[model samples]
Target: MKAVLFANTDWYLYNFRRSLAMSLLRAGYDVLLISPDGPYGPRLRELGLRWEPLPMERRSLNVLRESALLLHLVRMLRREQPDVVHGFTIKCAVYGSLAAKMAGIPARINAVAGMGYVFTSDQLKARLLRPVVRGLLKLALGGEQGRLILQNSDDVKLFRQAALVEPAHIRLIRGSGVDCGKFAGNSPRKNREGATRILLASRMLWDKGIGEYIAALRLLRNRGYTVQAMLAGTPDPGNPAAIPEQTLREWVDEGTVTWLGHVDDMNALLASVDIVVLPSYREGLPRTLVEAAACALPLITTDVPGCREVVADGVDGLLVPVRSVEPLAQAMRQLLDDPALARRLGEAARTKARNYFDERIVIERTLGVYAELCGPGQEARQRRYG
Candidate 1:
């Protein structure tokens, strides 16, 4: 059997879906990855998997470019002719599924990582785009041969209410689960012991609560708390919410936070910090929180959909209101001042991660989905729907 994984960015395959590919290969299925060419493309090649480059634009709203992209994907799907095609992210899922259908592919799967900003508003664009996307999704997932996978219940409920997908076709999975064993608890990094270090690992986007995090940091500093802040991850230039490099540099210079831009060793970084913070306005399920929990670090995050799934309020971490600085500051201060409380929370978090978000579980479940789609069941599905 053969499977093709389609994504908008090469980084998505590299960072998150590599395990799934490896699992497929181990299960004796040929795996092919299709994404825009990048530095990570060669790495995928080195993994003995087939790699195809597509000209995908991540944040463009250009109709002509997107149509061209759809044409390219359709051609690729016809040529490669994989048994099953799985699409990730928003645009990829929309376009890839449509192309796979056009090519008469037997199995199609769409993984909705997050609802994203497009579905978060009541603007004319949102109103217009939602129906268009929903129409495309309905066409792609309407048949018995396709499945729609979501990361959180909130997204599942929202899309169901919107009538974007049939309830029977939708399946739920945890945010690409983390490797608890790999990110297991470790002693804090040897450092200036007197200070508290808080780390926020996410893209530099306004909706990610970068502004709120900075404001909370300033508030904590003003209150004379011995604190240090770190921000990691790259900025998406095409994304409207991206923070300017100059502003980020200014924050670093002002000593408000340490900017460790795009560190590969996230587990080590999480180990070094006293607290893991993600004040994101929303999430599909932030992998950073799962990694931190695997490392047995306590969390401070917003009371948003994806964030809430990871942190159990006061049990393993604290939840503050989305986009609010005061609540964030208060939560951070409470953890910083109360060492015993932080330690207890961290232990609780590690325990929870082991029980729920093990990476092996995610890989197994994902492979099961692939198997169901490509196995003998496909014949029955086609007979029923075709």
Candidate 2:
């Protein structure tokens, strides 16, 4: 068996889908990864998978360039002739499905992870681009050989309402799952001051509520609150919504919070933080929150779709209004002031991780999706549908 996974970035394959790719290999499928070559591409090679760097622009405005990308992918897919092709994010899903279809690949999978800024931003440009994006998505996912996978029910409804997918073609598999055992609780990092430690681990994107986090920290600092706050993760230069480096440097200079850029030891960092928070405006089940929960860290997030799925109001974490600085500060203060409640929430979060967000469960479910589309099943499906 042969499979190809297409994504926008090499980091995505390494960080998010390594487990799934490794599973494909174990199940006896030769895996080929297609993405823009980056530092992480070599890491994927180290894992024994063939790598092909596609010239995919994450935020491109040129239609000619994108069409060229599609043509290139089609030629590659036609040459490789894989049995199954999986694409992540909007561009990859759209272009990958088109390329695979043109190449006569038998099965295709497209993952809609959060719908991106095209749906989230309220700017005029985004509004104008919606119809075009919708049209492109319809073309990408509207086919017998493809299945559209979403992380949250909200996104599922959005696509269904847009008539982008049929009920039979839609699948709901929550965020790329996290390892429960590896992230089990460890003592949080403490300094001599014995202050509560809070961390936000995600790309430094405005939509991820990075600015709101800094504002909340400033508010806490003004109130003379002695809590330690850290922002872990680096800005994604490819993403248009990424916080400007200058702004990040300004925040660092202000000294309201510490910025730990790209902490490689995620488990250790989570173990060391008393609380984890993500004030994202929206998400397709943010992996940062799930990983933080798996590490037994109490969560503080907005009361939005993907976030609400993981937190039960006051049960496993506190839910605050989106984009509000005061409420965010209050929620963090609540967790910091009440150690007992924090512990209860942390424990509940771990239980939730085991029940719903285990990496193994997600991998199995994804493999099952792949299985239904490939091998003898592929022949049967083709005969039945063709």
Candidate 3:
């Protein structure tokens, strides 16, 4: 049997679904990756999967381009003729599902990583586009051959409420996955008398709460709290909600937060930091927080769907209201001043990562979804689902 996975970017495919690809390959299925070519594309090829580039814009609104993309996807699906096709991210899921249906593929899975900017935004364009996307998803995700995979129950409920997908067709897989063993906890660094270091690692987007994070940091500084905060991500020029380079530079210049730009080594970086923060407006599941949890780092995040799913109140991390700078600052304040509490939360986070958010769990569950759709077909019987 053959499996084709569609992702928006090669980096996302590599960073998120490598384990799943290996798992499928080990199960004797030919695994192929469909994504835009980038630096990470060759790396995926090196890892023993076939890479096929598809020209898809990340934030384009042109009707002609999108229609052309859909046609190209249909042609590719017809050509590949794989037994299974799974799509990640919004555009891929919507387009892949439709293309697969058009190509007469028997099995389809669309992973709605998040509702994305359209559903999350309060702007008029987003509000106008919301119903259109809902209508498209409802049409694209319908039929016996198609299934919807979501990371959070909130998204599932939203889809159902919008009449997008039936309850039976949706699978609640927590995250893309994170390697528990790879992100091991630190060996307790020496105590310092200076400021506690906190990090916010995500693509520089306004919806990821970069603005709120800076505000919180500024609040801390104004209150005479000596906490070192860093924004360890680069601006995403492709995203509509991206934080501009000028704004990021101004924050650094104004002493609001240190900008580390793009981070390559998250494990090592998480180890050095005392706390991790993700004030994202929404997510399927924040991979950064999961990695931080695996690294046994305490978290300060928004009390939204994906964030709440990974963290319990006062257990492994602190959850604050979304877009609220005071509470965000207060949560960071709690961790920075209380070393013992931070250590306790970090340890609990590690345990949570091991017990629940491990990559193995995600891979097995996803493969099971594939198996369920395939029935007693060519899939190996030894899969964890079987």
Candidate 1 lDDT over 89-200, as tens digits, reads: 7777888888988888858888888877566544576677777777777677666777888888898898788777788878888888777888765744434466788999
1 versus 2: better TM-score goes to: 2
Residue 179 CA displacement from its true place in model 2, Å: 1.3
Question: lDDT scores for all predictions?
Answer: 0.83, 0.86, 0.86
Q: How does each model score on TM-score? A: 0.95, 0.96, 0.95
Which tens-of-lDDT digit does each residue in 1-386 have in candidate 2?
89999999999999999889999999999899989979999999998888889887888889899889989999999889888889999888888988887888858898878978888888787889899989988887876778888998888888888899777889899888888778775544445256778898899989998889989998888888987788998889877788887888888887877889988889888877789999999999988888888877789999987888889888999999999999999998898788788888988887898899899988888888887788466787877663
Q: Against the true structure, what is every candidate's RMSD?
A: 1.8, 1.6, 3.3
Model 3: per-residue Cα lDDT over 165-265, one tens digit each: 87888999899888889876463344755678889999999999989998888888888898788989887777778888999898889887889988888
How many steric overlaps are in each model, in order? 0, 1, 0
CA shift of 46, model 1, Å = 1.2
- Superposed by TM-score, candidate 1 places the C-alpha of residue 347 at a distance from the truth, in angstroms, of 0.9
